[model samples]
Target: MTRILLALLLILGFAAPAAAAGDQGWWNKDWSYRKQVTIDSSPSGINATGVIGRTVVLVRLHSGNFTFTDAMPNGADIRFVDTDNKTPLPFHIEHYDSTVGIATAWVAVPNLNGGEKHSIWLYFGAKTAPVAQDEKGTYDPDYMAVYHFGEGPGTASNDSTANANIAKSAPPGVDDAGIIGRAARFPGQGEVQIAESASLAMPAAAPFSFTAWVKPAQLAGTQAIFARGGLTIGLNAGVLFVSGPGVSLQGKAPVKQGDWNAIAFTTDGKEGHLYVNGLEQATGPAALGAIAGPATLGGAAGQPFTGELDEVRLSKTARPAAMIQAMADAEGKGGKLVTVTETAEKQSSGGGVFFFVLSKLEGVDEIVVGVCLILTAISAFVMYNRFAYFAKCTKGNAAFMRQFRRMDGELVPSAEIPGLDKKEARLIKTSPLAHIYDVGIEEFNRRKARLGNRPLSSQAIESMRAAASEVVVHENHKLDQWMVILTIAISGGPFIGLLGTVMGVMNTFGGVAMAGDVNVNAIAPGIAAALLATISGLFCAIPSLFGYNYLNSQVIPLASDMGIFIDQLLARIAETQAEEAADNAMGGFGDDDMAMMEMDDSF
Candidate 1:
């Protein structure tokens, strides 16, 4: 038992390191692929077999060893780090559904020649810290609304936030030459509006921030870029101004025409500040409560600004200088920003198995696994004991048979047989040949004593034959001992495991009902744990089944050998009796004389 425990511990110790190594290799890895698509231009637009142009394409990308729910990954989620040199194709990811492991990207294949093949190499995942969208490596939730203006013709521009405040353009058009893929383009006569909604209305005298990228083609008389009720911020003759009721704040520096510029403004009931290209240009006192009303971009009636605007963002909180600077750097052409499709936790980092197993396994699952472990131990012990016993029996039978064959016509006593020591007797106890020979020798000696020098009768020979047959049956029974344990293990292991799995699945659904959640996180653990029980059952049964089959094969041959030995022993006895009977018949001794002779020999 102590040795068994030590052997189990050794197995565990060796397995732990191997499992750890496998976990690392399984989790901390990346996948990559490369492809070339030939382009064919048409009058409508350039066409490719797959998503070749700057259109959004779904892609199924893998990073580690596990399967992700999302089958289709986005082309935008993948950046073409290396590609055939023609013109650098600009690509950006629009959305990445990490749950499904799918992403959407818009690839700009404008410069890619039609009817020409473009080679691309796509690399997935990274080992280093992920790049953040902002320098602080955090995304601010204070942004109540963010509009990239990446809408198609006649579609409303969506606000990328928890608050879905969509803006509708009057003419409904998308400009491709914006900071991102597309931006809302407002002609002089057109305007984009989001009627008086609670999401757009800033709380009275509350801190607020507004940022936009604007390029004015012509800065004539006062042209309003943004207006909310009487509060209006616009460019008036090459100068930016923020006006609310009777109070107005003006920028110190003048603005230029036909150039893209980042403009930002913030107010906290006390002061109003304006920033141009991330630099604070002016500051002024703000009214207690600026009038709030319907917000409009581009002049509604007479004063419409003639330019392109892109990337409009509005936040409810007054952002710190660091955050503003970070935003500027990130949105600017050159900035230290990390762009990833998913969060850091969702990325592959080689640490999932432990949590995955723990989270999924219920109380019943643990119990089932424990039961399986016990079954495995029992199965192992049974197989080892039975295998050893069979091997020993086989060896002893060979040795006893070899000695028996060498013996002459006269059977030797057990004590006189070569190599038949006390130790050999203990081992040969399970040997059918040894058992049969011992029975035959004892019976022959008893019959010979009764008949003295006269040969034994047919009845004495039949009695010896019956004794040998009985010994053969007993020896066969000994060979088949403890085999039922193997049968139990092989038959019961899988069913027990299945019961545990069924219970686990039932519990998983019950948990879902109780928690009111049906997501993968809520259910994957329980399902995986339940499945583990079935795997454990197989683990217990497979070896036992194999061992039982092999032992049965060995036992059948040994039983056959035992039957043959019994037959041979009976034949030898019958032949010896026939010779003796012939001698006695030829001598023709009287019954009284025979009786006196037997008595004298016995004395």
Candidate 2:
């Protein structure tokens, strides 16, 4: 039983370390960290309705949601993978400023169902990773022009889609403080235009959608935000209005002045709908003939918008309302549609169960846990050694007692017992009872030599018994050697562990108070790491308590056996001496001589 228990413990101590959390089949082993990105379209989130087919979604990263220090400069190491963690998805970075800790990337998702959640993986932290930006591939072919307005001043804005619909002229003004990154600021004087191309050309009554984030500086007369041929999406008296050849749709929901709003207009060739901030504001029958003109943004030849424009997109197909809603929910300020989880580090194959906890521990906590581990090792060693020693003593004592019982009344040496083999002889030599018997035999021989033929008196027998009793006491002291170490472990281990835990918790709260952010994520890891010290303490103490009791129980019986053997040895010596004295007193005349004389008289 002892062997089995020890074997199990040894196995646990040396078992192969496991990875942190379950295996998710990492996309690539080279990347050292990955974070899960979830896009929630459920009721609790954006609540987008209907199936939003393949589309490009923006992933915004800032100091609040991302750790900039983990990624390389300019986010060159960044890679987006699908939920399967094996397939890489196409993504392109629109803006990345590591020093400011803000970035925005657009990734093409295969599908997003309403009332459902979609997940993707963002892997980074590789030192030698190559740049994986796919600008053209990030947007579908239906997208005619997608402008981020992030280019430097006086430079024409480049389109991100496959269609190279660059701006015909630079913006008159540029605002670095735009909603996402940079925006084209129009002071109601000049406008940016895109020359008509095969991709930008809209046929008669064709499906079309135009969306942009607009912040109107003033709401007075009509201001054209977008226009091409006879199609014009403008703001009149702070209200949204879209007009084309035979289409005239006006929105009742007024655009908030001096604030950004997602303005969009989508027409399915039969009807046109206007949206403000992701909600449908107005709808009416609309149609258009073949349009032939350059697409103008921020103004036309007569009306110029006095505001900022950003993230302007033009699609050949009329985008679904759900997609527009999702975009508005995700790109708006302080949006919650996309949630990026905390980063997870890659674990080596040799990592242990406490590896993560230990990594989080402070220096003082590490020292405390180290002490507990040392105590655990000490206790295990003591328990194993003591148990083995007790087993040997028990076996030898049993063998010695058996041989001594067969001696009848003779006080003979343990080695001279009949039918004894070398093994039994060795057992008797190490047995405590055999040692006590040898002490008694030596004292008896000393008394016999001094008294000649006289028997030992009562005083001499008492003295000899006292000598044997002293040997039994000495044997018990030897049996109890090193048991104090177990007592120390049982009593002191928990207290030591508690000291570490208290110190760790103090450090954790102190750091939090210093940081002045009291969120659960900021405090949970520290508290959990602090508790590890207490666990280590219990780990050291529990097994020692059980082992101490078990070993002490085994020692008690052996000590009792030694005492009993001492008493029997003295009693047998006294009985043999008394018989010898009686025989001597009768002048050596045996019982046989008396019986023979009585028979002769009868004849």
Candidate 3:
């Protein structure tokens, strides 16, 4: 015991290096420096040289610039060295940013740290240049960090920008990202600080402000970042908190996903401001008392952020948009390049609003709908006209039969426009009175030969005389072509109307289902469909049915009359034939020569 006590006393007396020496700074990060750095330069950048650390080293600077502007790189940074390969690191590199005119890049440093030093490089998109370049040689890569922002591909959020219900958990298309849903996100990953709540707590809430370079995936969550009953960002339901209360002065400044935006939400408990890329997107009206909520890194109480968020920052004072962008720019420096996925797109944070705005796009959708309607209407009109045309043709045919039957001229031309055989036409040309003959002259000759001038006064003459007793046959066939359209009118009109009604009813039912209740709103659409279709059907059918019967009635009587007229003409001609024969015989008829000749024809 005495030996132990003596040893303890000696050790206490000797004193030891402060055990908490390495745990005092920010993140107590792996770094080498005496105390801390204090940087303040005008129109010039700040840097930290002689500082040592393992592997990846970060040089943070707070600039008053906006989105990486209002400042330039100066000579205060430590020079990286490739102690092994005797080569530079900036040999193969690229840089990126979204400034007006800035461009910077980096190369690989295969010499130092197994090429860790020159893996990536970055800079502002414009005006960002390498710290220095060897005029005689390529960039040295001894001091480079692998940049991994905007390196991947971009994606699309919507195909036509008109989807009201965008799909979630889908492949984000190029140049677009995010979808519409409740708390929807994309490429989702993060650790839960606290399961029930964002179960993480800030060690000290003394002076805390939050900022992140992000591209929102969606604007559908009730809250983007909500803790307890307080702090929340994003389009929280219909509310937004730049950096203050959960519900203060709500504005309508929404952010689009898939684009690079440096957002900062800083509060001094009294005044809070929301900055985007070094400019204010909006301002908070609620004076924050203490951000009395547990610190949330990337999402609501329990939901992880669903989009790409880079360069997370938390400070005691509010960061200007410019400063945040500078941090991003600095990250894009020669090494350890920081980047936002200008190419990557998360889900949208505002799908409904976006579409709502788009729906209001002037004359776009309306014009499309109008064109569709015009096409439909034209189709309907053509169908209706066709139906009417069928009736008109049928009626006109009947009228032609009546007019022809009443004429005194011989019924030489039949309504059945006979297909003329060239041979028949030639034979008709040989017969002078071809107009009066239904049969070709060859046919007439053939018939006469069978009788052979033998006896016009015999049974053959009786046969002809019997037929002349009637004109119209009253036994016609082959008359159905013009009836089809009328039949269609009778049957199709009602069904077409019914179809419209059915579709309208279906629409109404759908509306009811969507609204979760049956009401007048739901019923109106169905009724409209029903009424319109029914009306259209009636429009099609009525005339068709009427014209069908009218044409048939007019045609039947006229056709019968035409048959009677033909019968009367045949009978009269036969009687006159006998008389003419008698007269000729009385005038100069004899027995031998003339009689023989006459006999030949008569037989």
Instruction: Estimate TM-scores for all models.
Output: 0.43, 0.57, 0.30
lDDT head-to-head 1 vs 2, winner: 2
Model 3 scores worst on lDDT over the 10 consecutive residues at 175-184
- The digit string of per-residue lDDT tens for model 2 on 1-603 reads 222232232333633365563345878877877778888889877888898888788887654345566689879999999998888999998888876556888899888887889999888878889999999999888898999999989998889888999998998889887877788999998889899899988889888899999999999999999988888899998899988787998999679989889999998888888899889999888776778779889988788899999999999889999888888877786455676753345633344434444445666777777777787778999899988888888888889878876776657777667788999888778788888888898898788778855777789888998999999888888789888988888999889989999998887776544332344544666776788778777877899999999998999899888877877888888888887777777787778998997899999
- Which ranking of candidates, highest TM-score first? 2, 1, 3
lDDT of 1: 0.60
Instruction: Give the per-residue lDDT of model 3 (tens digit) for 1-603.
Output: 222221221221332223232323222121121112112112233222221122222232211011132224332121222332123333221222323212232222232211122222122222333354321133121211111222233321211111111212222222221110011133544321222222123222333356555566665654354233355655443234543333254444665555545556665545566655544555654455444343343455445455654434344444333344444333332212222111111121222222221122122222322332333334345445544543453454344434334534223333332444564444433321222223222232344458442224456544553443221221232233335656665676667656655655555455334322233322443344344445445555665567666656745654554445444444434454455556666667666867788889998
RMSD values for the candidates in order, in angstroms, are 18.0, 11.8, 27.1
RMSD of 2: 11.8
The total of clashing pairs for model 1 equals 13
Pitting candidate 2 against candidate 3, the one with the higher TM-score is 2
Best by TM-score: 2
- lDDT tens per residue, model 1, 343-387: 112333323343444334555777776776677788788788878
Q: Sort by lDDT, best first.
A: 2, 1, 3
Query: What's model 2's lDDT at 588?
Result: 73
Q: Which residue segments of model 1 deviate by more than 4 Å?
A: 1-360, 418-430, 452-462, 580-603
